[model samples]
Target: MTKSPRFMQIKTYLLDKIESKTWPVGRRIPTEAELCEQFSVSRMTVNKAVRDLVNEGLLERTPRLGTFVCQRKAESPLMDIRNIADEIKERGQLHHSEVLSLKAIKAPEDVAMRLGIMLGGDVYKSEIIHFADNTPLQLEVRWVNPNYAPDYLAQDFTDKTPNQYLVDNCPLSAIEHTVEAIMPNEMIAQRLDIPLEQPCLLLHRRTWSGDQLISAALLYHPANRYKLSARTSL
Candidate 1:
């Protein structure tokens, strides 16, 4: 096997320190010169490692104070159907949700296509806003196949998220996701408490349970306040 890159090795060393709390958040890391001496590497190699960490949001550079570990951006896995509430709780923050609407409705054309149902078929629709530490984080507009989740509209979303309830009833077997960045419309802007011109990330997701399409959702988040990340190894 080929040897790993020198910069990658240095990066891993720094990451190990941060993850172990040997270099806790807000604690300034050693200077490039110091790292270069300690690793017996060139200053350019040390700079590259630190720069990569900064770009990845693990370290931040101060004008004259040096680099320090910083609190990471709120993140969700791009390839996973994770519960927003659980993610917030894992970060040691409070999670709250508000149900804007929940009722049965005739499936709209787009919703019908996504859920693989008739255009006018009966379906359950719900709109909810999830908050992390009372700051709006996501707006979820979902349409569910009544056959799969008959009691979807009856449950209180504030007490439990739609995702949580769906998992219990639907037992997700497959999921599809499409992500894009777009300027929020008036209502989306107002709900997310951001200016209309500010860009937002939109995730269109469709889920299936045992080969039956169960639910489709449009999830929106403020671009600056939330991030999506995915990791994989061969």
Candidate 2:
């Protein structure tokens, strides 16, 4: 296996200290000069590591107050289909979600076609914003075919992740995923706490179980802070 880069190693070391409370929130970390001495690396490398961490919301630098350990932001692991809550917990962070909207509504033309239902047919619509350490990470907009997965709207998403609940109850037979990078709109920007100009990765997915369209969802994540990778066997 290839070893991790030195910059990444520095980043991980800082993050581990923060997560372990060795560097508490608002605690000033060593200065760049001090870090350079400690790590025996060039100032450029230390600057790169600190700059990346600041961009990632892991460290806050003030004009003269210096850099301090930021409150831990929630982190999500890249793994095979797993619950977002579980991902956050694995990182030792608090997970919370807010239901921006949840109701039964008529599907739009495109959504109806995707779900194989009439444009005016009833569909359970839900919009949720997931938070890691109180920072929004994902904006989820979903539509459920009530005929296949009834009582979807009544479930408590705070206690159980939608993916976990659906897998356990609906047991999809096939899943389709489409990913793209696009600029986020004002609404999505507010929800994800990203600048409107910042690009976001939009993941559109549809699932089927026993020939029935089970669910369709759109997941949005800030581009600079989030990434998705996969491996396939041919």
Candidate 3:
């Protein structure tokens, strides 16, 4: 049998430690040099092992400090399209939003593809930061098909969320959602008030109203602050 690569072995060792609570949550793991010596491997191999863990949200790095096991994330159902404000209120927390941008713009390549519109086609865009009890909970960057909701740019998102407005105006018939754990970009990190190195749970969603594509949205949530879950009846 072919032996597993050294880096894979190292990664498995680290995963076992974290899963078993041998390196309990919030406890810092050994430095690269220490891991290299312990495993009798190059620093490059040890770094690869640790880096993968960080990317997976199993570990995190702090400047001027070592890497530590991350805390358990708060969960949100992955299949739900419920209003953020209603969800927060159900949790007994205040919900508010900051509408950073709301305007009609020429669609970029990705936005055009997602909305099934021609490149450079006119589309309504909005960037909003949603808060729960004063802490940033989500950063919503959305592109809307103006044909579906002509007044998308005019609504006051602070008083009513884009989701609520769209549900009322368009009446969704179908929806698609894709979820992943990813490192936040600078703007997303800044908007969500998280560090650039921190992992984030990204949800890409598309909605359709009676066979007409309505909106495409990228929702970013800080990984340490949030997680995605799912359940279904058999």
TM-scores, one per candidate: 0.74, 0.71, 0.69
Model 1, residue 220: what's the lDDT? Answer: 97
Backbone clash total for model 3 is: 0
Cα TM-score of candidate 3: 0.69
CA lDDT, candidate 3, residue 86: 89
lDDT of 3 by residue, 156-212 (tens): 999999999999999989889999899988988889998899899899999999999
Q: In lDDT terms, how accurate is model 3?
A: 0.90
Please identify which of the two predictions, 1 or 2, would achieve the higher TM-score against the true structure.
1
Model 1 agreement with the true structure over 21-83: per-residue lDDT tens digits: 999988999999999999899999999999999998889899989999986668999888999
What's model 1's lDDT at 48? Answer: 97
Per-model root-mean-square deviation over C-alphas = 5.3, 5.1, 8.9
Off by over 4 Å in 3: 1-74
**Candidate with the larger lDDT of 2 and 3:** 3
